[model samples]
Target: MKKFSYFLAVMFLFTAFAPAAMASAPEKSNKEDKELTPEQEERLEEIKSRVDEIKSMDFSSMSKAEIKDVKKELRGINKETKAMGQGVYLSVGAIIIILLILILLT
Candidate 1:
């Protein structure tokens, strides 16, 4: 139990400090600051409109299949949005595994 607590403590510290460390890295040129191009920006606006339409929908009146289709569409839009963004995104599971590896190595 004590060892588990220590592991959690280390993991918490790592998760808290990791973002700070990454943020402190030297900035690049202004080009790197621009996340998306004009075409991508237009597409993003379309996506936002579609999402808003979905939100304004009456889901309760829809059939199960229709609901399923809406969910699938949302998932596709989510993937596309993520693909359009530029960054190294780490999932929670990946972060935990990385922290474990660092802990074991130390």
Candidate 2:
């Protein structure tokens, strides 16, 4: 019984500290932050702000399911932005083609 209790205590410590320790370890950069363009900086700031909000969130009183929803929301925002860029490219091409046809007709 004593051995089992000790094992449970160690297991609890690992479960609590492992993720926090790993999260603090810095990831290696394939690119420099200063070299990033304005658009890239803006996107990074937007994501950082969102994650900050999520981190400040009171997880002490919430369930795991709610945390999952927050991740899903962030992913959805990224997908929407990518689609909007594609739409903008399509619109620009169509406008150029229309202008060329109008010039030819006149």
Number of the predicted model whose lDDT against the real structure is largest: 1
Could you estimate the TM-score for every candidate?
A: 0.57, 0.34
Model 1 earns a TM-score of 0.57
Candidate 2 lDDT, 70-93, residue by residue in tens: 879867766755543421233433
User: What's the count of clashing pairs in each model shown?
Assistant: 0, 0
Clashing pairs in 1: none
Where model 1 places Cα greater than 4 Å from the true spot, the runs are 1-11, 20-32, 86-106
lDDT of each: 0.83, 0.65
Local accuracy of candidate 1 as per-residue lDDT tens digits, 1-106: 8998997888788777877876798866544456788999899999999999999999999999999999999989989987776334775547798877897899
